[model samples]
Target: MIAETRIALKNAGKYKPEDISTYIDLGGYKNAEKALKSKPEDIINWIDEAKLRGRGGAGFSTGQKKRFTNEAICDKCLQKYVICNADEGEPGTFKDRIIMEMDPHLLIEGMLIAAYAIGATKAYIYIRGEYTQSISKLHIALKQAKEKGFLGKNIFNTGFFLDIEIKLGAGSYLCGEELTLLESLEGKRGYPRIKPPFPAEKGLFGMPTLINNVETFAHIPYIIEHGVEHYRSIGTENTPGTKIFTISGDVKKAGYYETSLGVTLRELIYDLAGGIKQDKKFKAAILGGAAGTFVDHTVLDTPMGYDLLKERGAVLGSGAIMVLADDRSIFEMTYSILDFFKHESCGKCVPCRVGTTQLLLLMNQAKHTKSDRIELLNKLLAEAEYMDQTSLCPLGQSPILPLKSIKQYFESQF
Candidate 1:
C-alpha cells in the first residue's frame, strides 16, 4: 500500500490559507527562526547532504544552486536577489499554485531562509498574472511576514536583512524558464538568455541571484526543521523527501497528492488516486508536464525516482501525472501537446521558434493524413532531436519527450 506524505503540503488544507495566525498556530516560520541563527554554509551543507533536487522539472541540486550564489565572487556588485518562479504555467502541473494559495506562509518562510542563506537583501516572487487568488494570498502573507519581523531589515536582530516583493508575469509559458522570468521581471520581453553565465553568476540586473520555483522553495523549511537523515529516510537515497504530484485526466481523484519519491505508478493510480476513472484500463501517463515522456502499464511498477526515470528517457518534470485511459488516442494527445508548445514558443532562437512549428505541422499531418503517415512520423522524430540539440532553453527541447515516447511505445497508433 502506497501512503501519502505531507511534508511540503503539511499546512495545505489544514488552515485558513490567507490567515497568518493560522499558519503561526501550526508552527510556521519556526524554521526561519532556526535558519536565521545558523551559519549559511551549514545550511547549504545540510541541504547538499539531503539531496533535495529542484521540484521545478529540472531536478537540479538545490544546495549546489544556493552555494553558487552564496560563493559567487561579485565584489563589484553589492546587490543580490532571490526569485520565486511561481509562474506554474506548465500544462498539467498545478502543485505550485496549491502551495501558493493554501500555504502561502510556507513559501514566504522558505524564501526568507533562502535569502538569508545567500545574503540577498531583495527577493521577488515572479508569479503568473492569471493566478489572481494566489497573488492575493501571497501579498497578504508577505505583508504579515514583514509585520512580524520575519522579513525586512535586521530580521530577528541577526543583522541579516531581506525584503520580498511580488512581480506579476503576463502569462507567457516561456517566462517559466528562469532566464526568461528574469527578463520578464526586468520589464523586458520574455526571451531566453544565453547560458555561459548562469543565473547564479550574473542574474537580476547583473547581481548574483538565486531563483527556484514555488515547490522547490516550499521544501526548504522541512529540511531545516528535520535533519538530512529524516528527509532521506522518507524517499530514496539519492532523491530524498516527499514530492507533490498534480494528477489529472482519466483518474477518479485527480488533484495534488504528496508521496515519497520511490512510489510506483501503479500505487499512485490504484491505491492513492482511487484507480482510473470508471475503472477503465490504464493506457499511459505523462510522468511530468508537457515536456515529460509517456509511459505504458508495462512500467507501472517502476519506482518514480529522478535517476530511474532518466534511465527510461523520461523526466519527473514538475511532478505532473497526466493519465490516459485506453479510450484516448495517442496521436490526438501528441497533437494537442505539440500545438501548445508551438503556440507558446517565443521566437527568439531558430531551433525552438521554427522547430516547434515544424513538429506541430508534422503532428497535424499525422493526425489528418492516412498516406505516408509513418514517413511523416520519422521526419518528426528527427526534427524533434535536432531541436533538442539546438534549442536555446528547455521549451525548445520538450518536443523530443512526447515524440520519442510515441515512437517507442505507440508507433502502431500511427
Candidate 2:
C-alpha cells in the first residue's frame, strides 16, 4: 500500500482540466503572478538551489538550462523562445499524456513562469499528433487561460507579455529529441543538429531557445510555489522532487504513479503496482522505455533516481517501468525492441541507420544460427557500442542501452 507522493499531479483529477476557473480557485495562477513580481534571475537561482533536473530522460539541470538561456547573448532584437516537448513517443511511457489531459492548466502555468524567467514572449508545445485527447484538452485549457488573462500580453498589469501556441508532431520518434524537434519546429526535416550550439545557444529559428519536456515544465510551478527548501526535501538530495512513473506490462495495477525520486523498484512493483500479474514470478523489468535498460530481480532494492540507477548501470529514463513476468521471453522482447529502434531511426545518420538495421538483422539471424549464444551477444554488444560512439543523435546511440543490459543480465536467454 505504498502511497503516491504527488506534486506535478497534485491538481490532476481534482477538477475540470479544461476549466481555468477551477484551476484558479485552487490557487493555480498565483505562482505565475508571484513570479511576475520577482526578478527572473532570482527565479532561476531558486531553481538552481532546488536542484531540479529535467524529467525528460537526460536528467540535466533545469536551473542551469534556464540560466544559460537567460544569460545567452543574441542580437538583442532577436526574441527568445520557450518550447515544451510533449511528443510522448517513448513506448510504455504515457506520463506526459496524462499530465496534458488531466492538468493542462498546470502545464500552461509552468510554461508562463518559464517564459517570464527566460524573457521569452512566445512559446510552443510540440505534442505528438496521436494524442488527440491531450491536444483537445490543451487547446481548451489554453483558450480558457487566454480568456482569463493568464496568457497573451500584459498579466496582472505587470507589463510582461507572453503567448503560447501548439504544434503537432508527425509521428516521428526521433523528433522527440530536442535538436531534431527544433529542426522540425522550424519547418525543416526532423534531424538531430550538431552540438556546441545547443538549444540554449541557437534554436527555434536561430535564436536563443529554452526547450524542456512537459513533465519538466510542469514541475516549475510547484518548485516556485513551494520554496526551494521544501522542494529539495521531497526526493533524494541530488535529484529533488517526485517523478511520474508510467508502469505497465504484467502488473496488476499497471498505471501512472507519482513518487519521490528515491523510491525503489521493489516498492514500485510490489507495493505500488501490486506486484506481477496473477501472482506470477517476476522475471525482469525494463527501467525505462524502449531505449532503456533491462534488469533482473537482483536490482529491485536499488533506488530509482538518475544517479542511483546510473550507478547500477541502469537508467530511470522517462520514468517508464515495464515489468515482465517469468512467462515472457527475453529473446523475443529484445528482438522486438531492436526492431523498434530500426524502424524509428530517422536514417539521417550512418551509424544509427546502418547500426539499427544491422542489429535487427543480427537478431533475426540469431533465431536460426547454431552459433554460441555468448558469441552472438558479444557481437551484438560490439555493434551497439560502435553505434554509440559514432551515431549522431540519441536514436542512433540508444540501441546499445537495451542490448548491453540484456547481454549483462539475460545472457541465458540467448
lDDT of 1 by residue, 1-414 (tens): 877999889888888877788888989888999999999899888888899899998889999999999988987987989999999888899999989989999999999999988888999999999999999999998888889888888888999888899999987999999999999999999999999599999999988999998988889999999988898898887788889988899999888899999888899988888889998999999888788888888778888899988787777888999999999988788888889999999999999899988888777766656767667778988999999999999888888988888787778775
lDDT of 2 at 86: 97
Each prediction's Cα lDDT score? 0.89, 0.91
55-138: candidate 2 lDDT, tens digit per residue? 989999999999999988887547999999998888999999999999999999999999999999999999998999999999
Residue pairs that clash (backbone atoms under 3 angstroms), model 1: none
TM-score to native of every candidate shown: 0.98, 0.98
Residue 395, candidate 2: C-alpha displacement in angstroms: 0.6
Clashing pairs in 2: none
